[model samples]
Target: MQDEKLNPSDETPKPEAGGAEPEFDYIDAEELDRLKAERDEFRDKFMRALADAENSRKRSERDRREAEQYGGSRLARDLLPVHDNLRRALEAISDEQRAQSAALIEGVELTLRELHNVFGKHGITLISPQPGDQFDPQIHQAMFEAPVPGTVAGTVLQCMADGFMLHDRLLRPAQVGVSSNVG
Candidate 1:
């Protein structure tokens, strides 16, 4: 016998007289279905991971914006007392005191005006409620309640101190006296 190399292309399929030879296939229907299922699971996992990354990015951006807007809230809160004191000093000044020290009065007035300007520039607003206005617990704190004749209950009898708002947030509630009268 002569040595020969068998070539796959040279082989011919043989069939029986009444039946055909079955073609050998590496992958069957069940294995194909399994591969499709595995691919679908991987795709689903990848989509979930992608969505999580997007959500995280959005959350980080929102936090950064909030920090930028409200970062100085503590400092702003600390300065409220100074503003209150300065206003009280001006209010306590008598006409005789103003006449005696016109320059001092003017200086204090200028300082107070400048502080108001700064507050306005920084989105800080004053919530000054007048007497007889409706008392709102949302922005006003009841320091005291008294029964006053001819005054409706829950009305603001007196505004002891002004409230402050930084942007839309309350830095401090306005201190007030509410009427406890039934009328």
Candidate 2:
């Protein structure tokens, strides 16, 4: 039998079923620069978008913490007047009245104590400034200033209405009368 292989000049080749992609052998310098710029622009935009997403996530976490810390402030402030009324009721009772109505006084006292306990359980604290104590602007609001004997200026002469705080935030500032230097 004779050899059957054909020479390159004598035979045509058929294309493959799935053709391979063509390679870029030589690109123009200006075209290459334009392609690089487009790539860089897309990369910069992607990086900026990622940074913005990260910042938004961090901000939302901070906002959530603040909301949790100060969420109950409004309700706690509303309850302040009730606490004042209860305190006033207790203070209004004299020795004779207390003795005459021992059972009623006991009930009222118990209720007040229970309310205090509840406040304590919920991280609520009383900002009760006592006589001769230094007045603090952060937790005390000066309702009026007066000259009092044997007290320095800015001293808390009396706390008119007690303040309350929830956690680390002030729910209400204590209404107070402070001493002035003026005679």
Name the candidate that leads on lDDT.
1
Clashes of each: 0, 0
Candidate 1 residue 148 C-alpha distance from true site, Å: 0.8
Compose the digit string of candidate 2's lDDT tens values, residues 42-136: 99999999999999999999999888877777887888888899999999999999999999999989998998998898789999999889899
TM-score, cand. 1 vs. native: 0.83
Clashing pairs in 1: none
Question: Per-residue lDDT of 1-183 in model 1, one digit per residue for the tens?
Answer: 999988999988888677888678799899999999999999999999999999999999999987877788898899899889989999999999999999998998899889889888888899999989999999999999999999999999998899999899999999999999996
- Model 1: lDDT to the true structure: 0.92
Reference-based TM-score of each model: 0.83, 0.79
Question: Weakest 10 consecutive residues, lDDT, candidate 2?
Answer: 15-24
* Span of ten consecutive residues with least summed lDDT in model 1: 16-25
How accurate locally, in lDDT, is each candidate?
Answer: 0.92, 0.89
